[model samples]
Target: MRWINILLGLAVAGILGFYGIRELLADPVYFLELFLGGLVRGSIYALIALGYTMVYGIIQLINFAHGEIYMIGAMTALIVASVLGLWGWHSAVIAILAVVFAVVYSCAYGFTVEKIAYKPLRTAPRLSALISAIGMSLFLQNYVMLAQTPEFQPFESLIPDFAFWEPYAHIITSVELAIIITTVVVMILLGMLIKFTKIGKAMRATAQDKIMSSLVGINVNNVISTTFVVGSATAAIGGVLIACHVGQINFFIGFLAGLKAFIAAVLGGIGSVPGAVLGSLVLGISESFFTGYFWSEYEDVFAFTILVIILIFRPSGILGKHETQKV
Candidate 1:
């Protein structure tokens, strides 16, 4: 299976490269635009994927409601920003506060979701937990729709409108620059948290062996909550950035983005942070290039196709290592 997956991956790469080269030859200028779009979009996917991957890593359960958390984040940001506008206080500083509010709200929602929906099922069948996650997802989506209106809300970009390297090409926009920079900074901080901090050590220990970590006094529940908090916070940031870039968002946005991020998590190896990021980049870049140069109608189809190809070849996923269980 591994060999087959490797071969298929190579084949896909070759086919994509063939067409990509042709497209580049046809229009180098437009290709650059597609590349930039992919990079920014991929960062958003990576942010959401971190939440899906992290929860799975610690609890061995997929928190399907995570996408709704992303949605809630964006909703929170929009509400806050719009309210502040009513007070005649619209500025970059206010925008930053809106993001902070979103992050805090997301953290609370993440914790509450875990405690109410997942805590009781800690020792139950994994399937039960999975079902609960799906239920929570539906509930949140409707709850938000009723509370915040189902109509699409436009997000204001805090960064002033500007362009760089205009003469050379339509290189990068201000919002895209903000997103890429924010993602890079957040990823670096996440890496450091996982590596240097005491809580990071506890979380790693918990992920490795929950029973042993508990025996050694690691307060496993706290670590799990912390994981959700961090994951939710990042997803919140992703939500705000995505809203700003796209300029509009609806309640249903989370479902699609969540599915893509879930695929990315699986594609890159669900339990590995770096793998999640890598998968997101690959999916994002591939999707952009396909829609840009080929056919926009099949953009969503492209990610699923890659998912099927990857699953058929390697059930463990691109960066996932096979594990054996003993009875």
Candidate 2:
């Protein structure tokens, strides 16, 4: 009965979506612009969603602090750029260094966060670990507030002002182009790394069964730490690109982005990488179209509404595999 309802709902959605796509494409210029915007945003969401999915897949923990890790990354970039600007550094140099510094600091933060906040709770009750994650999130947010001031910091754009076929609905900006390219490249490289590398094998093994991986002489703890590092690194890159695109940052910026990315992870199937990517793109495109056509203030409402529908119909997500437990 449930499957029937889901199939019916999906069919209706597909029909509506087909028409929507046609309407959007009727104006190729506008459609291209909106699509590029959504792709950029979705790329960022997918990067962050991978972290959520990976952490949950391995340990079944949400690591709510993940968003703050992204915040730290953006904050690091902002600081680095500001400092370089004061030194009269070239825009290119400033941009490159800012991204580098952001990634480094985020990696360090990620490693420390996992060790201090998550590692201790590995043997504790599930609820306890969850509470600890929330507590750490608050602690990181407040810590940044105190350290960096609770004001919005302006991020200088490193992307040169360049556009392609601007008369046709501002086809795409250089920043957006770079973001899309970088995201796709990184995802591909990551996929290849996971598929072929030794560390990747260990990660896969650990994800499958930590106890068994450890029994077979795999360093489970190292794999877990590496997972956090990789996730944080991707988030850091996203922070750099997003901040460059948006031109401002604040202590609280990560909260909403984190929430949306988590939603994307859940929507894509909590443990599937490809699912995360698909979910992020869907959520991003939907939000972009909604904001453009409907009132901007309610764009978020539309996104959440979609989430509700997906949860009601396909809680496992578009590509996520459902698991069955046997007693």
Give the candidate number with the greatest lDDT: 1
lDDT of 2 by residue, 18-135 (tens): 9778877688667767777888889999888888888888888998999999999999999988889999999889888998999999999989999999998899998999999999
| TM-score of each candidate structure, all chains considered together | 0.95, 0.94
Once superposed on the true structure, which residue ranges of model 2 sit more than 4 Å away at CA?
162-169
After TM-score superposition, the amount by which residue 92's alpha carbon in candidate 2 deviates from its true location, in angstroms, is 1.9
The lDDT of each candidate is 0.90, 0.87
Candidate 1's TM-score reads: 0.95
State the lDDT of candidate 1 residue by residue for 1-327, as single tens digits: 658757977897799789888889999878988898899989999999999998998999999999999999988998898889888895876798899999999999999999999999999998999999999999999999998788887777756675453454347787888898999999999999999999999989999999999999999999999999999999999999999889889898899999999999889989889989999998998899888868999888898998997787665677888868756
Q: What's model 2's lDDT at 88?
A: 96
